[model samples]
Target: MRPAPLNPLTRAASLRALARTSPATPLDVLVVGGGVTGAGIALDAASRGLSVGIVEAADWATGTSSRSSKLIHGGLRYLEMLDFPLVAEALKERDLLLTRIAPHLVKPVSFILPFENPLADRVYVGSGVTLYDVMSARVGQKRAVPTHRQLGAAQSQERFPGLAAPYGGIEYYDAQVDDARFTQALVRSAVGLGASAANYARVVDYLREDAPAADEAGAAGGGSDGARVTGARIRDEETGAEVSVHAHATILATGVWTGEQQAAADADTGLEVLASKGIHVTVPRDRIDAPARVGVITRTETSVLFIIPWGELWLIGTTDTPWREDVGLPLVTATDIDRVLEGANAVLERPLTREDVVGSFAGLRPLLQPVDGTGDSARVSREHAVLEVAPGLSAIAGGKFTTYRVMAADAVDFAVRSRFPRSRSRTEDLPLLGADGAQLSASRRSLVLANRDLRAHGWDEARLDRLLSRYGGRLADLFALIDAEPALACPLPGAEHCTAAEVVYAVRAEGALHLEDVLHRRLRLEFEVPDRGVAAAEVAARLVAPVLGWDEDRVAEEVARFTSVVDARLRAEAAETDAGAVEAVAAARPGGGQGRRVRRIARM
Candidate 1:
């Protein structure tokens, strides 16, 4: 069942695979960045039979990939801009992910756009929603979801119940996803397809050498005859171990860190990426009385506001502002939070407050620098651009999460021109790790499985549903953990819905190397809980210590560090100004230092 479960992403496997790859026998492709685009590139190249390896400075989706509105739709705003090609391309990719690529992870979601001016707003917004549905349907064999429909004030009030707008609204369908997990799934799928991937392996420097005998005589080696990028020197963030990897081609999908990475390689990146910071806050679902399960979209002074629904919580507010501060910790200040609350409260029947917030996060979008440098961050083009930053090295930037696969394919197609000319794009029809054959809906098979599991262990329906959402059809993997250790089946402390087995599985199967990685990225308890996972930090650390080779002191250190990080975030969120928030967050940096230190050396 479930295709025997795809290959697990263990820590040992990552280190060993990196050890096995070297410059003498260079990999066909080396991807720098473990975000969605880089992971997708690795899968695309490896699926096409290329020997590929991907490395990240931190965990997968530790950057902007995880900090999105979590929508998989042709940006309706782009339609207003008259950018049809980008919209069409995104719609096609969205359909692909929903139908074939990751059916288990991507699902349709409905959204309502409240209108103050019934007639004028309906005509304006209705046309856009209709066009969005039309564009999405035209890209695939079947309509991905129900088309747009108009609703009267009574109906809108019935659906939302907490409507501040006097006029009725129009509802349309898009899609929502767990952005972090979706990114992790991409990496896991790539690894399953023979791609070597390692998180926390920071690529510090470039490895260059004279052209090989197979190359055109004077094609390489400095100046016009550029030196080829043989590989890169990488450092293990955990143990500080260093190694060099040889790759025929190196692809940089470093997102907002594109400049720093290209600068380390000592080459002109050709394109500049402006870091546009976006912030999101989470509140309990009960705070909003919308029983229709429909997301809310409203216009803000800057851009649009999306109030997406999470399991028991509602994900709200995303402010688009230019950020030039420390990229390591993008903290949300009081002003940012207030801006979000004000925007949402202006339209919601009941307003959310600071006391209602459970968690918040901020991330930078690697928007392409405007030629005139005059437009707002929201007006910046999201189209990806690829360029040869150096011989045998290519970098791609400025694409959205929904279009990562297409961006990856395009980047690989550019990288392999002179090197692996035989390699071709093959990920168009490829499904991710959990998306194999026929996938039973969560309600369909999970209900039966939950009934059996409940009879056997008296597990709650919430726990089973959480497992299905995280693991999809691979719920058997958790079952295997429970079989091995009955005690692990118990719910994790402070995070009752999560099991101790899941924490252990995060390390042994999901390559969770650090306590923070497990809590923040894998288990996601860090933000989901009001304490920011503090109550579960020690429990999680102790549970995962053996698998990660952490002793008592290390466990204590991890727990303390995670607690401090949470404290810092809370303090930053309380700050009145950006400067004060940045200062407070900087003090909370693990070890009072920068996020990850990447050292580039020529003679390493």
Candidate 2:
């Protein structure tokens, strides 16, 4: 059976559903993080016919999940590391997502692994890419992308003009997504399947049957009475209110906060995860002079660099290094920017400068640390570990964005398999909210013809195509919003690619609690633009204020708060050192506009 359409992720609906789970009458499963894994878990549990609730500390995908390299390919570098299982597993899931799960959110993208030394480099790299394809072919009923093809030096240069050396290249296929939006889609899909979810809801402490007080180390959830973990004492971060959400089983997919959760749960058993900071910088599409959709993948001394082609800009990234600083403040420094620029310049025909960079971001990967602590994050295992931290509590850590579904299932199997042994995960076959509509509309002409009303409002085929690509089947919802108010059919004030209806849909349908969530995650005006979306922040706030019931002062505060955050990121990006960058963004650490909680919510 096809999954139902999404439910509006309003705070009112989420809280009312959460209020149903009490100590006496607990829900089936409580997923304690709302990142990709947690959201995936909620959907996985719900699809398998279980009552589930997923809560996040901040907005969904505000962690590592949102800040990925935005690639959905098997780890080609892992093949070099001789870890075939990880690559194979990821390839299977990758195809599943591309074909069945999230066809709308994830799309096929091509990359050129350019060769400087055609002799040995071609053989070594070509062999690995061949293996990557074979693994994918063996995974599922249908292949998601085409196999790799080798090109000559001139041929490669003709295909990808940005190649520094025209010694030929291996053209391979992968998929890319708007990471934050993909995470949000996963959430809405889960909600459609009856998973109660809310952002800005933090779990303060675990709710257990019998537990002891803190020790010298301030340990929580410890007891001598054979205590079984029940649920959590959650604090609404938007409001100061607290709630007791009871559950039969609890799963923790908190990513980098795994260690802290271990101590919080007072569990002697679990995974030891380390934080690895990976940063990326984005420049205008014309900077490197690359082809329409073809990107370059070059090997760095430490890790591989991906020059991913996002909508209007080129995303160059990823430096993997040990990070021991605050996880929430994952800001990029001058050194990080310099490293990324240098890595890209090594492959690009034209070098990218600091001024060319429009925006940058950093995400902390939760890697399963080796016992000796090799200090090299690249050497650490990306494979996740799931174990019972307590009787009713289970935690999952490590793994990459590509394999979140497998991780979620593993975590669920550990937490609930023993209790409900017959229950199996059904998410692999479930299409996310927007996927059905995207598949139904084959091309731009079909979509434009279907929504002739958009043409009446001066919306062209390009605008309609963009909407379908972003919202998929959910595009109808936007059309409905535009029909309600013709003004909503217009584009956002500063961010021209986004429509005014998106802001309202973000508030009403998506769970965008603050200005930051809508701009940064929903519209992606934050990292995609040069001004870091500060230009559109005010207009966006104004558009969403009425739906959220914000007064003039509140709208001003939202705009001001988002502007301050943008300024802080700029200061951080300009700072000389990583430590200096951290200090620069000290003021922007997640919780500024919490004085007055949202009182009213727009009905679905």
Candidate 3:
């Protein structure tokens, strides 16, 4: 069946809905967090005919969701830890995403793991990758991804010229995705399924009804200590409006902020989430001199580094180090960049330098603090745990991107059990917003459609292909924008890959309230471009201003804010020490760019 188009999320309507929540018509489930898992939970609950609402403090994917390694594969390293179940479950989810859930967003990519010890290492790594392929095939879904194969050193170098020569390697298949876009699509899909979702809406505190009088206390669930959580007090970040939303059950999927969310509910649960920082360095693909189609994966002393191929860049990452700083602002320091470069240089034929890096981003992984004294966050299990913090409040934390759907299902299963024990999760078979129209023959159909409608307005095969890949069946919306104004068909100056229509569409269709949402999440210009979308910020703000109802001054302010964020990131990345990077990044905080005086005044 063809899914219905999603409703547009605007500031006015979302705020109005928040103001109207009452005990009479309370939401069946109120989900906190707008990441992949929370969006999945909203979709899961809404598909089963439940009233669901999800709220995010910042723009969608502003946290770890946007700053991932972007792979949708089973962790091969987990297999060495004798964790077969985790690998098997992840493979099944990967298969579902590749074939059914989000085929347009998730595409398969080949990866080669180089080995120095020809005989023993090849036997070990080859056997591991074989098992990985076998587990994926066992999922019973369509094996759209191919199996593993052996590659000689010459073959590996021929496939990937940038790699340092090794004895041999094992080539295997896995899937990659635009993680931020997928998360937004999930939220949109949930909204389409009758779920209410809002970004830039922060939940400050839970609303627990006061204890009844002494006479009525006995009648009301035995005593005053038996009070249950009723709802939450949400603060709208844009307008600073506070509203109370009543819900039957509240689910917290805040990744790194799991502890904070629970504390807001006054729950004294021992759900410790240690924040482990991982940084990724983006370099222009040409500088790496590697194949555009293949990715390189190798083991570093700390963790594995993946050189994944993005559209115009190579994303080389990730150092797993313990982080004790503020989780809200994770800065990519010189040390972080140097660590990544060191890892990449170990495998590349040509060593990468600091100048080779075009962009860098850091994300925090919410690793579950172990009780048995496992110090390494990498060794910690990616399995998530759900805790019933109170009578009706549930919080889940510590899971990988591949198993988000499962985590959502489990969290929702726990949250809704008391109310609707019979309700089962239907998200496994439920496709995302644009999935139904994205068939195997979608490319041929889109080309024909684009030629018919968009040929007159500067759209060719290449432009239509890019739009079709991102929007799937929803390409009609972009076409409509172009039809109204042919100038909207023109692409951005610095980032020609994105059009003005996309920026407008982001504010009007997607829930983009700020310039960062458009540049960082919607268009991906922040990470792809060297200036981090500063060159295109003015154009984007101007294009989206009319749609977003921004005045001349407001447009200028937005552009300035975005530029400051870019400058702050660059300064932080250039800092020599972690402490120095943290200090530099503080300047980009809410009122920081304006100065310490503004921050003090704002706090007052």
Better of 1 and 3 by lDDT: 3
Decoy 1 TM-score against native: 0.91
**Candidate 1: C-alpha lDDT:** 0.77
In model 2, where is the ten-residue run with the lowest total lDDT?
595-604
Cα displacement (Å) at residue 205, model 1 = 1.1
Model 3 TM-score, all chains together = 0.91
> Over the full model, what C-alpha lDDT does candidate 3 score relative to the true structure?
0.78
lDDT, residue 231, candidate 1: 78
Q: Which digits, one per residue and each the tens of the lDDT, describe model 3 over residues 1-604?
A: 3333322344556567766889788889999998888888898898888989889887777788888899998888999998999999998899888888888788889998998898988899888888898887754356778888898989888888888757978889998988888988888888777777778788988977654443232332221244567789999877788999998888888888888887778864536788888999899888877776699998899999999998778999999998787777777899899999999999998888998888888888988764232111112235777766655676778888999998888888777765688999998887777775554355775667566565655566666666766887777787788778878888787788788898888887778877888998888876788888998998899998876778999899888888877888788888977678778867556663445212211010
Candidate 2 off by > 4 Å: 1-9, 138-142, 211-225, 370-382, 439-458, 587-604
Error of 1 at 539 (Å): 1.3
State every prediction's TM-score relative to the real structure.
Answer: 0.91, 0.91, 0.91
lDDT of 1 by residue, 126-172 (tens): 89888888788753277778898999999899888876757999988
| Rank by lDDT (best first) | 3, 2, 1
Off by over 4 Å in 3: 1-11, 139-141, 210-225, 370-382, 439-460, 587-604
lDDT of each: 0.77, 0.78, 0.78
